[model samples]
Target: MSYEADVCIVGAGPGGALLGYLLAKKGLSVILLEQNAELGKAFRGEHLNEEGEAVLKSHNLFEAIEAHGLLRMEKLEYFNNGQLFKTIVADPTVGHLGIHVPQAHLLKVILDKTHQFPHFTCMLNTKVTQLATDESGRYVGVVASKDGISIEIASQLIIGADGRYSTIRKQSHIDMAKRKHGFDLLWAKIPAPKGWEPAIKMALIGDKQLSLFAQTNGFIQIGWNIEQGSFSELRKQAFTPFIQQLTKAFPDLTEIVVQHIQSWRDFVLLDVFSSHCDSWGTEGLVLLGDAVHTMTPTGAFGLNSALKDADCLASLLSKETIAQFDVQVFQQMREPDINEVLTKQIEKEQTFAANFLETAS
Candidate 1:
């Protein structure tokens, strides 16, 4: 099959979807493809910093998102050994602040809004298999597979918004900067028991044994950050003992775990920084989102950075000001934020690690 569009964005995640939404709003023909069979998966990145919120507002998505019953967590709380450790209030006068909202829900809101434009098309269950470029090594189009059929979509540009393990970035042979910390994270949620305030994002740490993050749905989005291979050892001890460990770490938090602990999961944290050739476009190809730079979520900046990318791309495409807007504008606009995002993430990871080591040990 063959199709033509002004912009073909791969991966219908936050970045691709939002950028597609903005570009299409400008009447630039855009086609979006996602490998997922459906939306609403448990996406890991979930916070929307105040900067991210402001960007959404500027793009006319803030109100719609807020209306979706997103959790308005007024403070970001970090526990040292529990005991109401510290709080980063949503007072912008001091700095930036964001709240907790499932990233998938946010994406749905943007996609729904972007759909209002006739130029926008989101192809679900579609996978971009190959990048087609001209003789000059310029990206020209993409070949994707949907169901039993192979479809080729040619556009003025191809944008990759896939996640951390980006197939597009790997396939393009672009150099990627990667850092791995042997530390990993285990995440889960438990129902909130009586007297649990479920209104704020609460983190409790204890004896270097467990960490908990409280969620809004009368439950806590709990994570147990441990040494890379240590989780398996801990899991072997059974959930009851595991919850006990959390209680031991923050004795005050014991009540919640004893009553509200429901379940949990483990994950390895990674920090990735990468970019395409100086030519984000050989002819018409580009990269966006984690496909470009997968930042370790520290200050809850992954979504914010992605929004920054989408906003810049939207601004460029919407204006179409430079006549020939290609790789240069893309790189120039993206570099600073990408760097800032990476630098900021690394710093946070380090800080979290140090704090954990100190408190837990």
Candidate 2:
């Protein structure tokens, strides 16, 4: 099968979906391709900082997302030696310390909105195998297989939103400088404690950090930091002591943790990494979100930054035709802000111990 569009997006993540929606609404034909059969298959970090809130609100999408489900965090608390050391209340200027919304709900809502436009088409279970290039060696589109059927999707422009391990970026040979944060994460989710306030809780345990976030679905998401490449050795040791340390930080959750998290299999290991591509776009192809700048889940900047890219790019696309699109202009407009956020995330992770108390007024 052959399909042609004014804009071809290779991933249905936040950046691609949002950009597709904006372009289609402006009467431009857009084809959004998703390798997965549905949304929310991956462990998308469900966090929205103030910048994200502002972007959604600006687009008049925040109300719709909140109507689906949203949890506004009340405060951020730090614990030291099993005692509360500091508390940082939610700032009114910043809206809230954090907002949690399931990625499934957010993406579904955006896609549903896009469906209202006749120019938008979405393909699920479609995986891109290689970049489609012209004889001149310029990127023209992508070749993908859907349900074992090979299809050629040719477009004026191809947007790569396939995330950190992006096939499009890899196939295009866009080199990304990678960095490891010296630590990985163990994530688990269980029912929230009864009468628990919605907040982000952090504790220093064994020279590492344990973070608990209250979810909108009445669950508590726990992320424990461990030395990079040490999970295998650590798993061989007993789990009781580690579980007890978590209970010590929040004693009220002892019974809940005991009931839900029994074995090592209950936890999911997250390999932490940060990377930035040497360039974001070339000619007819461009990259966004984790594809161009993969972030550690430190400051919850990944999803929000993707939205910013989509929002900015959509603004540019809505005003100009594909022929007028300059990939350099898009890069120039977005790179500074992206770098700023990246630097902030790195600084936050590096000096967290030293500035732990300073964060609390």
Candidate 3:
């Protein structure tokens, strides 16, 4: 099968989906492709900061997503040895320090809005095999396989929002510099105890950071940091002793933890690293979100930055004709802010332990 669009987005992630919707709303033909057969098949980095909220609101999407389901963090509470020592309340005007949005809710709202445009197309269970390039070595389209059927999509602009491990970035020969944060994360979700407040709770456990985020749908998401590349060795240890630390930090979770997290199998390990590309695009192709500037799950900046990227890129594209598009301009406009966020994440990691000590003192 063959298709054509003004823009072909290679990932139906938050950034890509939002970009597709924005472009289509502006009257451009758009095709969004996702390898996953369904949305929200996996959830990661669902937290949205103020920047992301503003972006969604600017597009009049925040309320729609909120209607689906969301939880607002009321404050950041710091605990040491299971004792709450310091609390930072949310701003009165904003009413939230951060918001927990399930990827399922966010994507469904955006894609549903996108479907209102007759020129918008979403292709699920499709994987791009290769970039289609012309004799001049400029990307022109993509060749993909959709449920065992080969398909081709031609577009004037190709966008790679495929994620940190981006095939489009690799095929475009974009160079990315990767940085390994000192820790990886073990994530698990358990039922929230009745009367749990919507807040982010932090604790220091043997120099590692443990966090509990109150999530929508009556759940608490746990993020436990471990030394980089240490999960395998750690798993060999007695699960009871290791899991007991969680109860020590938040005794209130004892009942739920015992019920939900039985073994190491209950936790999902995420290898954490941040990356940045020297260039976001080449000729007819461009990259956004994790594809070009991957952020570690620190300060919950990754999702928001990607949302801002989509908003800015969509604005820029809306103002230009396909023949006049320039990816460099977009990079120039966004790189400074992105670099500042990256630097802050590193500094936050280094100071995290000290912050606990200072607060306890």
Candidate 4:
């Protein structure tokens, strides 16, 4: 093997970067690939749930994120047509009000930290062309491309953290169950009001409608749900009017649409998933993050779910030399939690989207 590593991880997203960092920390050689020329700058879940916080703390990345400015939630307000119905006060005992940090910035820090390790190698502008395995069908390495040259990188194991639309998952021959629900979330970053802070806000419309607002780095995340087919028309409209309509729908967010919304693409997220693979392991190859399971964006556990995969994968790989880790154990241990949380997110988003569709009809 010209270039051999302990683990070859695909994707440089949060899950991949965080996982790479942990693998390197364990004194294992790891190589990570990001197909994009640069990090993604799209609007994603900026809020971190309590479960996610545990993963960061375990990896000693909590303080690094907290220092970037974390806004604690004092309360999560639910409203109906602007009238407050109920409130869930932040319970510090139960990890109420997790950290608020943008995905791009958070992943950047993780990438930078991973590079600090001698055994970690992260390649940007590289795409995985083919995943190679030995004659016995045990996973080995990959065939990737950079600058139009096909380069082969061998590894003791291969990890797929490539996310929902993963090419690696397809190449791995994992029998995945994919369910395309009827709803999709519209994700966007709305600027806070002139004097308001960015916290968690759940505004419910009286016509059986629901909308979400969470804050990160002083910006509120707005996710509106709609039928899966509505995005094409929605994308053609200007964002300001859409946001203005959204502000009108909920009084909790009056004048909060000041977040420099010059275009609609800035607030677009047309995806819904209730998907999982039959297994996450195949000899020296394993699937992690959205590559293995799809999560709905409920209370900010999307990226963290992937990070947890990284954590467990590192643990499994570490024990491989001393004892052959049963990858099936890892799969069984993680699938339930991932599926449970993923179902919650999908259901919530679907409920909201259903209401919106009802109103629109």
Best by TM-score: 3
Better of 1 and 4 by TM-score: 4
Winner on lDDT between 1 and 3 is 3
lDDT minimum window of 10 residues, candidate 3: 315-324
lDDT of each: 0.68, 0.88, 0.93, 0.72
RMSD of each: 3.7, 2.2, 1.2, 3.8
Query: Candidate 4 on 1-361: residue-level lDDT in tens?
Result: 2577888888888888887887787788889988887786655566677777888888777788777657666677665445555666878696566667677767867877876788888888888999888899887889999767788899887888888888888998888898776667777666666555444666543332345555654566666666667788866776667666566656545644554555665666658765788888688777888788877666567777887777776776662461355678889878888878877776675464343332242
Worst 10 residues of 4 by lDDT: 352-361
Candidate order by decreasing TM-score: 3, 2, 4, 1
Each model's TM-score, in the order given?
0.84, 0.96, 0.98, 0.86
Candidate 2 clash pair list: none
Indicate whether candidate 2 or candidate 3 has the larger lDDT.
3
Put down candidate 2 lDDT per residue, 1-361, tens digits, no spaces.
9999899998998778888988898888999999999886787788998888888888888899999999999999888656677889987777689899899888988998986887799999999998888888878988999988999988888999999999999998989999998899999999997798999999877667789999997999999999999999989999998688899988888899999999889999999998897788887888999999998889889999999999888888853667668877888998998889889988887777773555345
lDDT of 4 at 56: 84
Off by over 4 Å in 2: 318-320, 355-361
lDDT of 3 by residue, 167-207 (tens): 89998889999999999999999999999999999998899
Could you give candidate 1's per-residue lDDT for residues 126-193 as a string of tens digits? 88788887788777788889975899998777777787777777678766666665456666566666
lDDT of 3: 0.93
Residue 297 shift from truth in candidate 3, angstroms:
0.4
